[model samples]
Every structure is written in C-alpha cells, then in structure tokens.
Target: MIRLDRDGPVWTLTLDRPDKANALTREMLVQIRDAAAEAEQAGLAALILTGTGKVFSSGADIDAARAGLATDGVWEEVSSRIARLPFLTVAALNGTLAGGAFGMALACDLRLAVPGASFFYPVMRLGFLPQPSDPARLAALIGPSRARMLLMAGQKIDAETALAWGLVDRIVPREALVEEARALAEAPVAAPEHIRRTIKRMIRG
Candidate 1:
C-alpha cells in the first residue's frame, strides 16, 4: 500500500505495508510513480519517500515478481520520473533497502537512513537484470566497484558502510527520519520555484 501526506509544500510518500516489509506490488509501484508525477504537476517544494516499518522494502512482491513485475518497464518509468523532478527529493529509508527498490532511492537527490538499515540489490543472484537506470545511478552514488559489490557480488551493506560509501547522505534515528527530511527541505521549499530549479539544474548539469 502507499500513502501520500502533505505538509505545506513538502509531501511525503510512505510505503504502508509493514506486515510484508513493505514489499511492492505493481499497484504500489504505480502509486509511487503517480505520486512523483503529482508532485511535479503541483510544483511541490520537496518530496520525501519513506516506509512504515523496519524494512523500507523487501523489493518486489514475490507473487508479482514471478508474474513478470521484476522486469517490467514500469520500474524504469517510476525512477525516471523521480530523477527528472526539479524539486528536492529525499529517500527517508526507515530500514533496509533491497532488490528492485534500489531504483527509487538511487533516483532521489538524497538518501537518509536509520542506523540499523542495510542496503543491497540482489538482481544478479535473482537472475534478473536490474531496471535500466539503476546501475548508472548506483555507480554514480557509490562508485562502480562498490556498486559491483552490491549488484554483482550480492553483498549486503550496513548503514554505516553505506554512508561511508556515499550510498546514503546521513544516518538519522528512526523517530526523527521524516522530521530531518523536512528540515533539509526547508530552504528549497521556501525558495522560489525558479531559484530551486536553477540550483538543481546547476548541480545536476
């Protein structure tokens, strides 16, 4: 399930199925993709992605994956929409991030995680190529060799190691994750849209 919350100009999109470790079904992925589009259409200041439980996402729902969701083009579309958004984007990782779910976090401008979170993408071991945009984004964040560690070697990295490798920008306590994300967005949210867009373009260009 997916829940979108608005606080003034900042919107937080939460993955709400804790019982399943927030495993994503195709419907959930579509909701996430639609939310990203909605944020851009509304000219929102910031968008924060987070989840309700101790695991951000266990990746695609097993049943859905077996039904071909694993290689679905919707994954690329979702991450690409987020990556192209001009507003500040943050992935407030409540717990471990795994599998195909890596794409969304990688597309975000920043990623923050709880101290206990771990990161991994088992695409290779799972016998599926990752979503098209994922490898490039992953290499851009944490470097090719380290990207290889996760994607190729199938290693699970702890939060501290993730931070050290640049996979996550900061490690925040679980209780404060969303609050910290809002704080980071304060400036961008308050700035004029043009100014925010300009800075983002400058940095990303």
Candidate 2:
C-alpha cells in the first residue's frame, strides 16, 4: 500500500507495508503510480518517495511474481513517471534498498539515505537480469564500474560507500531522514517549474 501526504508544496509518498519489509505488490505499484500521477497533476513543487519502518522496499512481491503478474511494464511506467515529473523528486531510503526497489530510487532526481541503510543488487544471485533501463541508470549515477560491481558481482554497499560512489547524495541520521528529505525537496521550489523541468529534460537528453 501507499500513503500520500501533502505539506505546502511537497507531496510525499510512503510505502506502508512494513510488516513485509514494504515488499512491493502489483496493486501497490499501481497505487504508487496513480499517486504520482495525481501529484504531478496537482502541480506540486516536489515529490518524496520513502517507506515506513526499517526497509525502503524488499522489491517485487514474490507471491505476485509467482502469480505471473508482469512487473517490468509497471516498473518502467512508475519509474518513468517519477523521472519525468516537472518538479523535483527525492528518494529517502530510510532503510535497506534491494532488488527492483533500487530502480525506484535510481529514478528519483536526488537520493538520501539513513546512515545505517544499505543498497544491494541481487540480480545475479536471483537468477534474473535487471530491467533494461536499470543498468544504464545505475551507471549514470555511480559510473559503469560500480554498477558492474553491483549487477555482476551482487555487491551490497553501505550508506557511506554508496555516498562515496555518488549513488546517494547524502546520508542522514535515521531520525533526521524525513526532515532532511523535506529540506532537499524545498530547494527548487523558488525556481520556475518550466525552467526546472526543461533543464531536467535537457540534462537527461
């Protein structure tokens, strides 16, 4: 499930399935995509993606995956929507980030993580390849070598290492994650929305 909250110009989307480590399900993904679309339509200044409890997300739901639900399309759609939002987007990784959930964080314009949080890519260990766009996006953030270390070697990187690799912009204390994310989200609010969106597009291109 997802929780959407608005405070002034910032819209926050929190993954609420803490009992399962916030493991993503098809229905949850749909809700997240819809909430993001709604936030964009409302012309919010920024969007924050985070999770409840100690894990950002455990990745796609195994039950859903076993049921043959197609996740690639949903992942692509949701990530693309967040990536192309006219306003700033931040991923506050309050805890562990693994599997497909990494793609969600990578899609965000900025990333913040709790000092104890960690990032892992388990595609090799899981006997599956990452989504096509994932490799390039990961490479873009932390460079090809580190991306290779993650994807090919199944390396798990701690917050400090991730920051050093340029994967996360900052590492905040667990208690300060939300406040820090809010501050980062507030940074571009004074800029013209069109200018920010255009520049984002140009940079991506």
Candidate 3:
C-alpha cells in the first residue's frame, strides 16, 4: 500500500501497510514507481518517502520475497526513477529500514530518521543479492567498510550510529520527521525548476 500526496510543490509517498510493517509487495513497488514518475512529470520540487507506522519498511514481504520479489527488477526501476529526478528527494525514515526497501532510501538525496529507527540490509543472510544500484549507492553514502558491516555482517545500527556513519543525514523526533523534511524542502520549493535542476546536477558532478 503506497499513498502519494501532493501539497503544492512537495510530494510525499507514504507506505500505508503498517500492519505488516509496511512490507513491500510487487504491486506496492509498482505503485511507488508510478507515483514517483507522476510526481516528476508534474514537476515536483521535492519528494519525500516515509511510512505510516513505527517501521518505514521491513523490506519485501516474506511471502513475496520467496515468490521472487526480492530479486525483482521493479525495485531497481523504482530507485532509479527516484535517483534521476531533478528535484530534491528525501527519505523520512519513520522506523527501521531493512532488506530491499533500502534501495529507495539509498536513492534519496538526503535521509532523516527517528531516534528509534534502525538500518540494515540482510541480503547476505537471506541468500539473495541486493538490488543492482543499492550497494554502490550505499557505499557512497556510508563508506565501503560500514556498508560491508551492514550487508556482510548483518549489523543493525540505530539512528544515532546511522547518523554518525553518514547513513542518515539527521535524527529528528518522530513527531517532527516529515515536518523536518518539508523544512529542508522550503528553499528548493521556492526556486525555479531549472535553477534547482542545475544545482542538483552541479552537486552530482
């Protein structure tokens, strides 16, 4: 279940299946991918990805993972779409982020998390490879050794550790998570689209 909401120039895509820790299914992944595309097409100035409950996402649903969802291309497609957007992208991690779900957040330009949130990707334990772009993107953010600690050793680091390791940009109180993201977006939202896009490309270079 994915909910995409538009508030002027900002678009927020929320994972709505709190009951299952917002575990992703193929259908949900498709929805997220489509929503990201729609937001970019509509010239969104900023996009935020968050969740409805204590967990941002527990990654792919267990049943779905076993059914080949873990290795699905849709995950890469979704993350790639987000990565290519000209606007600012933020992952407002509400809680733990695990498994294939790591791809989407890793693609974001910035990440903000709640103190209670944890980060890990258990591909090594689960006997599956991560999405193609995830490992490099992850290593770029947090460094190769730390990325290995999470991917190879299966270490689950808390919010503070994640911030220190560069996995997350800030640790915001849960109540203010999305608000903080919106605050970060204010400047970009007010700028011209071409100006924002130019700056983003300059940063990428």
Candidate 4:
C-alpha cells in the first residue's frame, strides 16, 4: 500500500509494505503514478518518497513478477512521469536498496540514505540488462567509473562507499532520514516552469 500525505508545500509518498519488505506490486505502481500526477496537479514544491520497515524495499516480488501481476513493465512510464515533475524530488532511502527498489531511488532527483543502508545490482546473475534510464542516472550520480564498476561487476556498495562514489548525497542515522529529507524538501528552489522545461529539453536533447 502507498500512503499520500501533504504537509503544507511538502508531499510525502510512503511505500507501506513492511511485511513484504516494502516490495511493490502492480497496483502500487499505478498508485505511484497517480500520486505523482496528483502532486504535479497540486503544484507541490517538493516531494519525498520513503518506505516503512527495516528495508527500504526488497524490490519487486518475484512471485508477482512470475505471475505477470507486477509493475515491472510499467515502471519506465511511471519513472519518466515522476522525473517530469517540476518539484524537487527526494528518495529517502531508509534501508538497503536493490533491484527495482534501486531503480525507484534513481528516479528521484536526490537520494538521502541512512547509515546502515547499502546498494546492490543483482541483475547480472539473471542475465538481464540494466534498466536503460538507470544507467544514465547512475552515471550522472556516481560518474562513469563507478557506474561501470556497479553495472559491469554487479558490486554492492555500502552507505559509506556509496557516499564516496557520490551515489548518495547525504547519510544520516535511520531515525533522522525523514527529518533531513523534509528539511531538504521544504528548502526553496527556483520553480520557474519555462526554465525548468527548457532545461529538461536541453538535457534530453
């Protein structure tokens, strides 16, 4: 389940599935897409994404994926739509990130992780290629060398190492993740739509 809350100009989208380590389902994906669309419509200045429990997310449930009831296919559309939001978006990484969970985190403009959190790319064992947009974002965040190390070698980096690689902007105690994220979200930015659109066009071009 996904929880949507609006605290003044801040919008918080929580992925609530602690029982399953916050794994996302197809319905949750639709909810996420709708949430992003609604936040855009509401003109939110900032958005925060987080999950409950010890794990930020365990990625997509393989059972659901095998059953063809997962959102794996629709994720690109959802992620692209989320990236189009004018507001600054932060992914509060409350715990370890891997698989589709990592993809979701990469979708955000900024990622704030907790100290105990880590990252892993396990797709190589499955013989599947990396997610397309993810590679570019990874490269932008961690640079070319680290991106290659992560994708080619399928290495997992701890929170500290991730920080060193620039994959994560800030690291804090698990308890402080939300507060830090909210503070960042509430901070001011130039939200000029035309400028943002032009910049986005140039980036895409």
Candidate 1: Cα lDDT at 142: 85
Candidate 1's residue-wise lDDT over 107-170, tens digit each? 9999999999999899889999999999999999889999999999999999999999999999
Candidate 4 runs further than 4 Å off? 69-71, 189-205
State the C-alpha lDDT per candidate.
Answer: 0.94, 0.86, 0.94, 0.80
lDDT for each residue of candidate 4 in 50-78, tens digit (9 for 90 to 100): 98987888777778767764435666766
Tens digits of per-residue lDDT for model 3, 1-205: 7888889999899999999999999999999999988988999889999999999999999999889898889999999999999999999999999999999999999999999999889999989988999989999988999999999999999999999999999999999999999999999989999999999999999
Query: Candidate 4: worst 10 consecutive residues by lDDT?
Result: 185-194
Tens-digit lDDT string for candidate 2 (14-59): 9999999999888888898888889888887888999999999989
Residue-level error in angstroms, candidate 4, position 174: 1.4
User: Which candidate model has the greater lDDT, 1 or 2?
Assistant: 1
- What is candidate 3's CA lDDT for residue 157? 95
Estimate TM-scores for all models: 0.99, 0.94, 0.99, 0.89
Report the C-alpha displacement of residue 1, candidate 1, in angstroms: 1.0
Name the lDDT value of residue 131 in candidate 4. Answer: 62
Candidate 3 regions exceeding 4 Å error are none
Tell me each candidate's RMSD, in Å, in order: 0.6, 1.5, 0.6, 2.5
Where is model 2 poorest over a 10-residue stretch in terms of lDDT? 64-73
- Which whole-number lDDT from 0 to 100 does residue 76 have in model 2? 77
